[model samples]
Every structure is written in C-alpha cells, then in structure tokens.
Target: MTAPSPTPSIDTLERRFSDFATLGEALDFAATGKRGLNFHDMRGNLARSYPFSEMRSDALEMAYRLIAHGIQPTDRIALVAETGPDFAALFFGCIYAGAWPVPLPLPTSFGGKESYIDQLKVQLQSSDPKILFFPEELSEMAGEAAAQCSVEGIGWTSFADRIALKCELPVQHTDATCYLQYSSGSTRFPHGVAVTHKALLNNLSAHAHGMQLEATDRCVSWLPWYHDMGLVGCFLSVVANQVSTDYMKTEDFARRPLAWLDMISRADGSVISYSPTFGYDICARRISSQTHVSERFQLGHWRLAGNGADMIRPDVMQGFVDAFGEAGFNARAFLPSYGLAEATLAVSIMPPGEGIRVELVEESELTGMPGAPDRPKRYRAIVNCGKAVKDMTIEVRDENGAILPDRAIGKVWCTGPSLMEGYFRDPEATAACMKDGWLDTGDMGYLSDGYIYVVGRAKDMIIINGKNHWPQDIEWAVEQLPGFKSGDIAAFAITNGGEETPAVLVQCRTSDEDERTKLREQIRDKVRSVTGMNCVVELVPPRTLPRTSSGKLSRTKARNLYLSGEIQPYAVAA
Candidate 1:
C-alpha cells in the first residue's frame, strides 16, 4: 500500500523566484525547503515522494561516485529520462559533477524495437557521451545503443551501489555549459543545443514571474522528460522555482489519461498543469455524456492550464471546456505559449486569465502565396501565442533578414539571455539558424498588438506553380472526414514528371476494398476543397505515417518515405 504524499506549504523557507547564479545554487537553496516531487502510479496512487533534501544528499553521492569513476568536468552524460527518482537524482548528479547532462527520450509505443534503437544510436553518436545512464529495465536497448556508439552504459540502480568518495566538486560559473538539449523530433541530423547555467536560470526566473506563480501553487505533469516543454518547463522549472510537483509517467498517461486529472484534483492547492493539444483532445474524448464530471474530478483548484509543445487547437480547448465546465474547469485558465529548444524553452507566454485567442487570416497570407482571381478566398484561424517573455525580444523577418511590420507574416526570430550558446559540435548548423545573437525560429508567424500568432513552419509549406499551400490546411480539412483524426494524414509537395503537385498520405483503417476506395476519394475531395487543386491522395495502412518524438506528424519524413517507396499505398480498384 502506498501512502499519500504530504502537501508542502510556504511557511518554512521563502520562495526565491530563481534569483541564483547557477542551478547548483538553486538546488542548494531548494534543498532547505519542504517542496519536492511526488510521483503517482497509473491509477493515480502515490508511488514515491522525493524531497529536495534527500535528493540533494543522493545527488552529492552520485556526483562523487562519477568523479571517483573517472568522469571529468565538461563530459557529456546521456540519460534516458525515465519518470522516477533515479533519473532525478542522476540528472542533478551529473550537474554537480560539472558534467553536461543530455536527456534522451525513452522508447515510445508506436515505434518498434529496432526503430527505437536506431533513434537512440543516432542521438548517442551526436552527443558522443562519455557514458549512458538509464533505468535497469531498458538495459538491453540502451546497452545496444551504447555499444554501437562505443560509450559505457550503466543503470543508475547499479551505479548507486558503487563506492562514492567525498571529494571537492568542480567550481561552476553562470556561463558554464549546463547541458545539451536536442530539440524534440531530432533523431535525424540531431544538433544538440548547448545551454549555459545563466540561460537556464534566466528562463526559470522568467516563468516564476510570468505566471505569477502563487505560494499555494503546485504542478502536475504527464509530459515526457526529453522534450523541452517537459524538461525545461515542468521538471527543471519546478526545481529552480522550488515548487512541489506531482508527476504521472508519460506511458501511464497514455494508458489512462484521466488519471492525470485525478492527481490534479487530489492536490489541495492551486494547480498549474500543462499539455499539448492532443493531451486535451484525449481527455475531452474520454468521458461520455452520461458520465458525471463532478463525481470523478474536482478541478476548481486548477488555476493555470498551460497549452504548448504543439500547435494550440481552439476546437480541442472548447471541447475540453464543454466536457469539464460542469466540474469547475474554467476556460480562462488556458495558457498558450510559444517556445523552441534553441530558445532554451519559453519565448512567449500568454498572460493568466487571457485564455485562447485567434485571428482569421487569409490562407494565401499564411502560405505566402499570391491569391488567384479564379479561386475563392479562404481563411484559417491562427491562434495568438501571446507576448514575448522578459528579455526575449521577438521579431518577424523577411527572407533577407529584414524586420516586418505588425501582422506581417515572416520567419519568427528571437534573441535573449535564455537562448542557447550554440549547437554542440555543429558550428555549421548553428551558423545557419543563428545570426547576430538572434535565433531564427523557422516558424512563420505575425505579431499584432504585442501578441504573436504563429502560422506554421515555413519548411512545411508546399509550393507549387509559384503558389504556397500549407499542409495543415489540407490535412485538417481531410481530418473532418468520418473515421479520421489528427495526425492521420500527412501532406507535402512532391515532384511528378518535372511538375510540382501536392501529395497527401493518409492512414486508412478500413479493410473493405470498396470502403478504402471511397475513403480515398473522400479525402481527395476534402483536400481539393481546401487547396482548390487536384491532389494525389494515397491510402496507406494505419500507423504508417511517421511521427516526431513529441508525437507530432512529421510531414518531411512522410514525404521522404513516400517518395522512396518505403511507405506502400494500397491499390484502389478502378
């Protein structure tokens, strides 16, 4: 039987708003407080409660052990970020040992074993870590990847049993490289973003002030630890801000998403929780009309409902509100944010109580394509991602790097103390994205009245015959067809007989031959309604489309595989 975790109050040590020189100093201060992390099982039962005081002692021991085992300062230690105390202690342990901790993703459900190994091997090759630390259960896969990379692999459980000697920890400055963060979905051509202690601390401080995090505020998260939103926002931010947090493993959340809400509801104070659009979408879809929301959840204390890590969907937000409104879920708690790994996490955050906002922009404007007189004007709802964070200046720039005026769509660029030093060991790739201390966030968005509305990634735009078409517009339209959901369709531009045309790869689940053909036509018609041009729609098997590490549809990979004939489409009868 598991015991309930105690609620940490602010009566003991005063909250310091992350006003520290380094993360080590931040942890040193937080160790004096009662706030800590509480992890729950799949059923939302308390599994383990780890306080900062105990974790500090464990981290110090682990740090000494690393040094005693020949680990040196500035060495990179790859960690498979599992949702447990071992990962928590080892992550900070790497920092205390003056080594850069690289958080890697665990194997997801959709990808097969070899696929998972390939992804891990590539990342390990990029980071070239001195050692790989992972949970004992994943030793087989982690060991294979480590062997392929010629790096030592050690499970933290066994490593903890090793002898530790008390020795002087290396002195760390604010500018020292704290860690290397590979952006979500960076398995191919991965470029690790090296972040400094000052940058991480600055961003953590910005969060405390931006959200106006209250004393009674606690956090609940089901996000994976490798993604920036999960790492910098929920985990590291929780530590640097000295706030108690409840965590449900990402896998557990996938199996039983409602358990996330249960944990949040069980907490006694104001709750600050986050999820992408898909997370909200699943929860809203889980409950039926007959199910009583109040009987299961008491969400009145959830003050800050954060939305990010993917495109924010107003429809999904509305669905969630409609489902849980009767149970005290407020619409105003929605917080849409904009960020990237290169920025170290948050670039802009919507103010509290602002909720989700949108603007209907011409489809041509969003795609950077000139409108044709013969075609009807169409519009897409672009969500407002809110104002830039403190010290982070955002600008819309043209292809020539010239700044654009308000509401003029262009490449999104940001520069601030929160930005990374550079892509580790990849100067050429770093130079391509950074200029004059500003990071060119390949996303295209416009600013209006101090609020930013992100359109889409410029690379994902499909240009054919001098007109640009956004894959999202076509994909969203196709998703409206029955039996389809988000990420079921991938749209991109393909070259056919020396001519460019839009190609759509949709995952068709229907087994009947006639139904599959009809479904393909339905998707084609739906896409044509959005693009105003004929599109080649291929009906592939379900789960055939590729997804990023963050579970986002990867149109680029989909296109590559489709063109290379790796993804086979079913034959439709004439």
Candidate 2:
C-alpha cells in the first residue's frame, strides 16, 4: 500500500472553460489531463489522489455494472454523497449510463436516525430512483429508508463487486436531465429539481468565467455534496473547468474545521475555497481558542473565498479576517455570491478582488415596517450579494409579478441558460415558482447599481401589524448575546392575544434555572431591541431547533414543532 499525494494545481493539457455538450463530454476532456480530485483525511492529510483519467475509467466500469443490471436512460439513480471516490465515480457513472444521478445527503449530528430515515424516505419517494447507492457504514439506515420507500438499496462496495459486461455506453442528449437536485430545505414535500446537461454545463462555464479561472487555480472544499454549492460549484465545476481540487468530508470539516484551513495553508498554488457564512463563523470562533494563527496557517495564496448557500454575513467575514489576516488571508479574497439549485448552481457572483461590501438601510426600507412615532430610526446593514452571472438576468418583482425599479425590495427573479428545466415530475409545484421564463427565487431582495442585496427568504418573513420583518434579523439579534452561536436560534411569527408577534426559540445549554432565566431575559431584551416590541422568548434544550441539511437554521420546522408541541421549551424557575 502506498500513501497518496495530491494532484498538481497546474497541468500541461490545454485548459477549456467548460464548453461541452454534456457533463460526460466535460469529464472526457478533463480525463485527458493529469488534474483530478483529491480527498483528505480528518487531519488534512491526502488519503487518495483520484486523477480524472482514473475517475472516468472507474465511472465507465460502474456504468457497465449499472447497464448490466438493467439501468436505463433517464432513470433516477440516488447515491448518498460521501465525499469520496466511490460516490464520485458512481455519480459520473450514472451520467455515462444515460441515467440522471441524484445526490442525497449523509446523516448529520442534529438529526437522529429516525429523522434521517424520514428525510431520506421523503426524497426517495419523491425521486423514485431505480436504485439507491450508499456507503457500507450507512447501510442500516439507508436500507430501512429503502425498504420503507419500496426501493432497492445497495452498498456501492457490494455493487462494485458485481460482474460488469463490457459494452458501449448509451448516447446522451444535452437537453436530457443530467441530474436531479433537491434543495437543502426539501424536507416534508421534496421537489426534485431536474437540470439538463446543457444547463449544467452552461452554468459551470459561466461560473468559471465569473470567477475568471486561471490555469494555476485549484479548488478546496468541505461543503456537503448534497448541497448545490458543494455538488455543482466544488465537485462538478472543478472537473468541468479542468482544475485540480482537494476535499475534506463535510462531517470532518464540522469536527475539525481548521483542518480545512491547514490544507489550504499547505497548498503550493492559488487556492479557491467556498462556504456559507456559518463555515466562516465556525472557523473564526475555533481559531480564538488556538494560539499563534500565523505559525499554523499561510493563506496568502488563497485567491477566491466563495460565500453562498446562505445570507452573507459581513460581520462573520470581518471576524474571519480579524483572526487570519495576520496569517496572510486577505479580505479581498471574499467572493460573496447568491444562488440556488434551480439556477443550476450560481445566479450571481461578486467579481474577484471585491471584498465584503455592505449598505446600511433603515428598517422601514428593509421591512416596510412603520417605526414608532418620534422613535429613533433603526437600520440594518445588508450585504451586497454580487451581480448576475453570465447569460443570466436578474430582476426584482413585486407581489403581482410586476418588475420593480432598483432598490425597491421585492421578490428576486432570474432567467438564464442555467435555470433548471423544471422540478422533476412535479410540474404543478414547478409552475408555482416558474413565471414565464423567469425563476421566482422565493427570496426577498433589492437591486442597486447592478448589484443584488438579499434580505432573506420571503417565506421566512414574519408579518406583524401589516408590516414585514425578517426572521433572520430577529435571530441575528439574539445571536449577538454572549454564549450564542450561529444556528442556535430560530425565529418566526406567532399569534398571541389575536395579534402577530415574533416568537423565538433559543438553544440553551445551561441546566441552571437561574442561568436559563437570565438567558431568556437576555434573548427577550435583544429581540425587543431588534423588533422594537417585546416578544415571546423561550429557552429550549440544545439542538432543539432544527437545521436544514445544509446546516442553516430551519425556523419553519421549529415553529411547526413548537406549535405542534414536539419542541417543548424548558420551564424556568420563578
């Protein structure tokens, strides 16, 4: 057995910017080059170096195995995204076999086994995959979900052992669905987003163009593969753009996040990394406990630090710069982007060299809420979410679908070559969001000077007294208190005494009644400051508030559970 060394950042083969007819075509071209995907262990040591040639070869074999087992074109093949060679090979193998590959999430710490099974079962039922492939470790849980969904489940290792008859792969169409992506928020009624190879390739091309990829660029990621940002931006985009890359398992990143930084520090060339705000938040907090950041990390070469999949938090970005700037991390590397699965991967990306930029606007401008008479005006800093990617047009539309002028906060809509063909097998659901040629992003935002500033998700808005309030504003307010971290709070609207007021459920780890009471008071006062009105605040057990698979706080789920009595807040002593 030999230890693995990572692939080089630059290769001799000519670089092509994802101008391919299909993802398979993209992989075929990339395989001609020496660059490929690298997987790292928990301590940031390279465990496997999977060249694109090897990946394509393994995928061809896997495709043969699937075909020998009666897999057909357009068939949905679900595979648990494990951030390894096996899953990667199987995903591309499905594409080679003319089947639509579906990547599902591995279990998370917040959700227990049953919860995971339920989430998997819902997606399985929705996707109706011909077969579900997962790692051997998750067989117990995946098997149960497969059984419940009445779908066949097989471990990739066992499936790989099957005899694969040598045969030519099926011909693929660019318009045919290349894959099915379920949004991270897809919990109860999951809609499988169907994206064509044309759309996928187009988005990857635009993404590369947006970032202005150079031959010396390399990618580093620890995002979960189930999420669009990870699957498309980190995994597929790298191969399509013919860039070598490094990856740490999402769970490993969660446990030892600084290892992600450690890998980037050791990288010899330009490093391109992406994460949601929470990733930056976690790293910033973790580094505070460690001594001598300069001695550990060398981030001068990290070229693009992409931020997406959640609201961009300038404060968190600033905290990260505060912690690592001494170690050669430049604030200019922050590349904030806005996107969703329906748009393939990216809708808008901040141009390179532009660090975090924010604009302060009054509460009335943001939420349309009327301030108290003679009360001081309140304002919030909204982070600029960048501009639309190539071949994509963004417009803000009011509730009636009429386009709004710049800076008038409204529903954000986008139309582009990369937009998903539609939600797979759910036209009714698809029609609800698709307006003519534009995709109603279901996000509330405003456009100013050709840049977008996303306030938050529209559905997550809390309405009180005919004015709208963002739950994130309330949640962020509570997070300002000591001992609180990101994802520790969930806020939503609740009706009490026939009037709507914000209700917050905060995760309290303290068992002391006095401490819990104090925490509750602190949270209540904080929400009062943000909302300008006193609201209900409850302290629940730690991890009570649910998070989407992508690790964003799920206020909708929390509110439903609280209303249904599933989430019971602790009764603080008087």
Candidate 3:
C-alpha cells in the first residue's frame, strides 16, 4: 500500500498560479515563448510529426475558412474523427472562432453502418449541431448518418486541405466558450459542458502546477479524445505545458495491451498518463508475457501517472506497482485525481512526488450505519483524490443540501472558476445542478483531512430495509470472490411498479452449475454481511455486463434488464 505524501499548503498552490491570467494565455505563452508543442502518431507506420505552432496556425486558418463558408460564431459544429492531429485542429478551430465543437466518438466499422447511423442520429437530434465536420476517410459513414439526421449541413475536410487554406485571424478575448464537452450521462441525458477560454486556462494552470509538469516531459496515452481525461489530461495539458506527446489508437491498445508499454518505452515519455485502473492492469498483464527485458524505458522517469475519470481502484494500483517495480517504475508515481467536464477537466489533484493515499473502513460504516472505529487499515484501500486545485472549493452535502463534515459520506459539490457557466441553454437542469455557486457533482464521497474519497454515484446508491449502501461496495466485494473478471461486477436495485421494496440485482459471470451456485451464495452472503440486505444474485455469461465505450460498467442498463426479466436470477443451493 502506498502511503500519503506531505500535503502541500494551500498558500503554496495559490502562490504558484499568481502570475497566469487565463488558461488560453498560459497555453499561448507556452506555445510561443516556452515549450514548442510537438505531436506524433505512435500508431502510424510513417511517423509524421506536427508542431504546436503549425497546429495552432492551421486551426486558426480552418476556423477562418469555416466562417467564410457561412458558419457563424454561435453555430454549433460536430467533429467526427478518431484521436489524431486532425481532431485537435478542428477542436481549437472552434475555440478560435467562438463556435461550439461537439466531439463525437468514432463508430466501430464492425458494428455495421445501420448501428453507426442510429447512434449518429441520436447525437444529432440531441445536440442539433448546425454542421457535421468529418474526416474524408469516414465520408461514407458520415454521409449515411447525415442522411438519417435533420442536420443543416455536412462537410468533409482533409487535414492537408484545411492546413493549405490561407488566413490570418488575431486571437480574441478569453471569455468565449472554448469547448463543448458532452458528459458521459450514464444515468440520464447527456449535457454539453461549456468550457470557456478562461476556465480552460485556470484548470490547466492549476493541473500543470500541481503535477509539476515541465517542458521536458512527454506523454504516451490511449484515452479517447471525446472524453475529458483524454482531451484535457493528455492532449490539452501537453500543448498547454509545451511538451511532446505520442498518441496510440484506443482500439489498438485494447487489442494489444503491450502496445501501451511499447509506446511509453519507445518515446521515453517522462510523464506517463492514464485514467484510473487502466495503465496498472495493462502493465500487470503485459509484463507477464515478456520474455526479453528491455531497458529503454525508465518507468521512474515516468512521473505523474494520473488516475481519474472514474473511481480509482486500490488493487489496480497495487497490481501495477507490483508488476513494474522491476522495470524502474516508482509506486509513488501513482497519482489519484478528481475532476469532471463540469469543472473543465480537473478539480483536485494529489500533489506529485507523493504516493497515493487511501483509507479503509468497515463497509457498513461508510453507508451511514455504525460498524467500526476509523483505523488506518492498509489492506482494503480506497484512494484519496487529494486536495482541491487552486481556486476550487469542495463540499460534501446531504440530500437537503446541508454541508457535512469530514468522514460523513455525501454528494460531492464543487465551486470553482473552471466550472462551466451552465449546461448549454438548459436552465432547469442548470438550476438543479448549480446551487449557491457550487455544482452538484452527483458523485457520492467524503472528505477526511481535506482529501476526497469517492464511493459511488449518488443516483446509483441502493437502499434496502431503510439502510443506504453504495453499489460499488457490494460489487467490489463480489468481484473479489473467485470466478469474476476485474470489471465484470455490477450491482443495481430494481423497483417494481406500485411496490416500495426495491430488489437488488448482482451481475456476475458463471457457467458451471456448481460454481454458479457457490457464486450466488457468496454474493448473497457478502451483501448480507456488508449491508445486512439479501440480494438476488444473477449469474450471467462473460461480457454480459454492459459497458460504456470507455469500458466503465453500465449499472442502469443492467438494472433495466433485470427488472424487465431480460436477466434471470440464479437459484441458491439447498
């Protein structure tokens, strides 16, 4: 288990960012005066490099041409491309032109054209984007989707063609919305998180400073650009700090885990990067298959391996450190972080150079029932996502919006400059989320000694017989038992119509009859032991558990299936 580092004083954080005006200015200054930004496509066999200055100039030119082609400042445009230099150019182009850029994830060609078109239609209907800008390679896919949707216009722009256009537009004020990040919306409808130039600047400045990022650092990442962690954490942060970055295709990394390690090793990337639980598990599995040892990558120099965009698992971190300890990776490089698209990218980051800090308590005590005293237990770890970034304030509050003290688990609320102005044009939703200048994060967690510990989503909390229990607690416990994949467990509550009692649904993998019976018994026993609630354990085949594109388990969809009788519950042994 990694011990906590010395917490830096708030005064230290405040003093560090006293000079920067905004995130855009900080990035512009870095690009022009300090770190000359450079990017490489690690997956490309040709090995082409795109400099930051050239990318910025290309973005400005593209934005100017788009405007010249009748696209207005307030027009919303959709970008459909994989993670690459083209995606970055279109994103920054929108920012320069004061347009909203909605980044859509690239569809799987294997899913067939119909499935792809359906998803694109749903996004277009929801966002009502004025135009769809796509890569020429995806022109066929884009054309099919555009035909199905009611979008006003559709255009294909090649990277070479966009850069070839001539334009000189002066950078404007820092108040315009720079990016429109769509939230994961796991539980409800997705909202566009409007991040302004000023907000982006503030978040990047705070994050870079907190991580001790330098111009000499390089990043190798497989996180997708449509997501906040990939866009801001990997790409924007690299550009803002003026560092070189190498990006690999997310699908390619998924198919070949060792490709991630190979890229980091080849790039000598000092700033190793990722969302929580990804890098650790990949390295653990990949290192096991290696026959020849290579000394090119020094994992120790891979400082600031960030964990965010989801709950940080202790076992994952431990597994990573144990696997790479021989390869010169420092366990202290594991940095658990907290952020959302609502607050740009990062709200709080654990100070770099310090190892991850975690807390252990009886599972029942965390769900509002009295169980045991707070002891420093190292075995069962829940990571601390350190202190709030500079200019941000975090408060844990109850259902009635009353703030709770440290150790009391509740909804995490944040107030900061990096927070979005509001969900675009959705006043009712915005009003519901923003209260007293604090954004209701919808995540459930607690603060102890100023460090935040997340349990689960507030909406995902399961209540049985008047006691509250986080689904993650039950899911984690079940997954730890034999015969379960690392991310295969999902626990949700099913409420029958006209009945108050909501039954629990536990999703796990089992095919053997005896093993399935034993797994069922183990799941029920764990739930009863932890929450004193009897749950219906459903044994499903492998990959039955639904996941978002980024691979986070989808509890809502699983619960819906259980309620609709699409999933059958396993019988307990006599």
Candidate 4:
C-alpha cells in the first residue's frame, strides 16, 4: 500500500464548461476519466484519493439502496458535510437518487455542544429532511437534533449497513431543485436558500469562463463544504471542470492552517484556492511565529489566491502577501470577489491577475445622504470586488428603488440566471427579498466604472439623526489600539431618551481596574474622534462576543445580548 502523492496531476480529461444540464451529468462525464478528489490529514499528508469513476459506482449503488429505503424524487436528505470520502460519495448518491441534499455544518470547536445542537435543530426544522447522515463522532448530537425535528438520524456506517436491496434510481431534471443552502446566521437566523440544477450549472459555468480555468489548475481548500463558497466554488466547480483538488477538513485547518499551504506548496502544479479575510489573517499570524516558513513552503505556483465569503480586508491581504512574498508569493495573486448564498455563490469576481483594487471615497459621502452634515475628516478604503460575472447585472438603487449614479452608495441588487428560486418553503421571506425579477441583496455598496464596492449591510447600518454610520467603521477605529484585534469589539446604535446613540462593546483581557478604565477611555476617545459623537463604552471579558457559523463577528447578535443583559460588563471602580 502506498500513501497518496502530495502532488497528483489528473489532467487526463479535457476541460468542459456549460455542457451539463445538472450536476449528476457533470459527475457522470468526469467519472469517464480518472480525475477526482484527494483527502489530506491534519499534518499535510495525503490519506486517500477517490477517483471519480470509483466514486460514481459507489454512489450509483448507494442511490439504489436509497430507493430501497423509500426515498422518493425531490425528497430532502440532510448530510453533515465533512471533508472525507463518505460525505463525497453520499452527496453524489443523493443526486443520483433524484433527492435534494441538504448540507449541514459540523459542530464548530468554538461553540459548545448545546449551541451546535440548537443550530442543527433549527436547520432540521426548516428543511424537514427525511433522514440525516452524520459521521460516527457526531452521531449522538445529530440524533438528538434530528429527534427534535422528528426525523431519522443514522451514522455513516449504519447508513451503509442498511443497504439490503437494490431498486431503480429516479431521474432528475434541469429545473428540479438541487439542494438547500442555509445561510450562515451572522446577522440573523439562518434561512434555507433553494437552488435549482439550472441555477447551479449557470453559476459554475460563469465561474469557469470568468476565471478562465484550465485543465492543469489544481484547487487546494480547507473551507467547510457546508458554506456555498466551499461547496460550489471549491468542490462542485472542480468536479465540473475535471480538475484535481486536495482537501483537509475544516477542523484540521483550524488547528494546523499551515497544512493548507503545505499542500499548495508541495503541489508542483498551478494552485487555485479561496478563503475569507480571517483565513489569511490567521495564516499570516501563524507564519509570523514560524522562523523557517520560507525554507519549508513554496507559493510561487499559487496562481489564484481568492478572497471571498465575507468582507475582503485589504490590510489583511497585504499582511499575507508580505508574510509569504519571500517564498515566491505575488501580491497580484490576490483575487477579491463578491457573492452570497442567494446568488448560489459568486456574482462578481475580480478580473484574472488584477488583484485587490481599492477606491478611496470621502467617509461622509458613503452614506449618500443629501445635505448630510457630519464629515468624519477621513477617507474609507472600499475594496473593488470587480465587475459582474457573465450574464449577471448589478445595480445600486436608492431607498426609493430608483437606480443611483456611480459612486453613490445604495442598496446592492442583482438579477442573474444564478439567482436562487427562493427561500425554501418560506414565501414571506422570499417575497421580502425578491422584487420584480431582481434579488435585493440587503447589502449596501456603490458602483464605479462598472465595478462593485461593498460598504456594509443595510440591516446592520446604524442610522443616527438621519446620518448613516457603519458599525465596521467604529469597530475598525477601536481596533487601531495596539492591544486590540479584529472582531474584538462590537458597535451599534442604541435608543436612549428619544434619541439614538452609539454603543460600543469591547473585549478586554486585563483585570487590573486602572488598565481596564484606561482601555475603555481609549476606545471611547477613538470612536468619538472618528464619528464626532460621545459613545457608551462597555468593557467585557474576552470571548464574550458572538460569532457566526462561518466565524464572522455577529453584530446583531452582539447587540441583542448586550441589550438583554446576557453579557455582563466588568465593574469599573472609581
């Protein structure tokens, strides 16, 4: 028995685009060749490689077994998406069985068991899946959550063991529902984004043409498959193009982020990968502590280092480039893009090789309010996310629904073939966002020269006295302090005595009363100087702030907890 090769080339197949009516067809075509997936361990060692041909056979058999188990066409089956051969085969099996696969997230290390169980139950209730498949380690918790939703839960081994008889598989159509994507509950509760096979294929095809993907392109990823960026961009896109990919579990990457780069560096082929801003931040921090990163990792071959899934931070991108540039990394490799689950994945991607463009706008002008007074005397660097992808239209509209001119911040909306059919079984929620034919993105941004620059979320914008203030601006100001880090503070507007005031919550690590008081004063002063207003500053212990399933700071949740008194502030003695 031989260990899997670190750099395995699977270019025996030709690159195909826009040829498949559904993902099942894409997989069927990919299986005809030898290209497939490789799984890597935590220490950057390959554990297994499952060719698409073998995977298709396993899935086909499993599809018949699912039919024997009484699953019908369009039936929903939830699968805890873990990066392994089991999940890979099961995901394809559900497709072949003509059933919709609802991908759920695994338990995060930061959240305790109760949090994960609650999240799971909420999603299960929303999707109402017929059965849930989970890894053996999480079977107990998955069972508890499934029971709460009145669904059946079984471990992967048990699922395999129950395949007693074979039956004919169902046929899937291009217009049929493909899967349910539950949005990461960052600003609010998670909603299931219903996508169709046509929408999925359209988005994937746009990705191929937009990126100019080639046969030799290799994808290395540790993004959780439950996320749209991971599922569509990394997993499905690679399979559709017959490109080889190396994957490490999201949990493994959290522990050893360098392993992700190790796979890329060890690859003697061109590498394409994407991650949020935090991923780059964590990796840069980890490598800063390492004295020999240059001797160990090679990044010159990293052709497309994509940034998405959240707000792209230019500072973080620069830090990563600086940290790894010595090892043959190029700053131009940074590909900043904009997307959401509602669009089925990417809507706009930076042109190939033109990385991280910034447009400096006057801070006060970002609010787009007429005759607005308070000028912050600062400029905000809004990163250009790039032009809309093929066949996608982006428009910036004012609150009155009128299209705004370029450089005027307004609600971001898009209409495209890749847009979701609607939210699953929630007509009210779907109607609220879908108007006419365009999908209201609920995000605030502006367009300049046909390029989109996202400023902030409309739901999270803090409006005080008719002037718009972004919580990110306030949080970023406080983070300028030497001891502060990203996501260490939360800022929002609070109602006080018939007027709205700014409230800032900071996570302090010090217990010394004087030091705590000094920190609070420093944060207060910084915010005041930036916004020209006095603010309420509360000092809470570190780790008290809340994060989304995808690890983004949840300002709405933070405000709720603070207002509800769930977060107790440190006592400041005079």
lDDT of each: 0.86, 0.87, 0.67, 0.83
Tens digit of per-residue lDDT, candidate 1, span 1-574: 6576654835377888888988888889999888898889999888888988888889999999999988999999999999888988899999999999999988865446775787789899999899999999999999999998899999889999998889999998899999999765434557799999999999988888889889899999998888888899999998899999999999899899999999988987899999988788889999999999999999988999998876677878999999999889999999999888889999999999999998999977875656678979988778899899888899999999899999899999999999999999999988988999999988899999999999877677664422345677678778888888988889888756534578988888878998987787787777665455678889999999998999998887787688657899998777
Write the residue-wise lDDT of candidate 3 on 1-574 in tens digits: 4531211111111123313444445444444532333333444221445666667777777777677666677678888857766777777777666677888767653435654666576666667787787777777877777766867445555433643455554455677777677753221245677777788878877887777765346677777777788878877776665566666777676676666666665554366576546556665766654533345345667777888876676776787777777767788888889888888888888988777787886555544433335644223356899889888999999888899998988999999888898887678888988887889988889999888888766677564421235676667556666766456777776534422232445555555678767767777776565445566666665566677788888787776666546666665556
Question: What C-alpha RMSD separates each model from the true structure?
Answer: 9.0, 9.0, 11.1, 9.3
Q: Could you tell me every candidate's TM-score relative to the true structure?
A: 0.83, 0.83, 0.74, 0.82
Better candidate by lDDT, 1 or 2: 2
Over the full model, what C-alpha lDDT does candidate 1 score relative to the true structure?
Answer: 0.86
Residues 262-298, candidate 4: write the lDDT tens digits. Answer: 8899875788988888788888988755567779889
Which 10 successive residues of model 1 have the least lDDT summed?
Answer: 461-470
Could you give candidate 2's per-residue lDDT for residues 1-574 as a string of tens digits?
A: 8887788898999999889999999999999989999999999999999999999999999999999999999889999999999999999999999998999988866446876898799899999998999999999999999989988999999998988788988998988899999876545557788999999999999999999998889999998888888999999999999999999998898799999999999887899999888788888888765578999999999999998876676778899999999999999999999988889999999999998999998876765556667889877788998999999999999998899998899999999999998998899988988977889988899999999999866787664422345677677778779888888988887757634578988888889888888887888877665455578988898878888899877777888789767899998685
Q: Tell me which residue pairs clash in candidate 4.
A: none
Clashing pairs in 3: 23-201
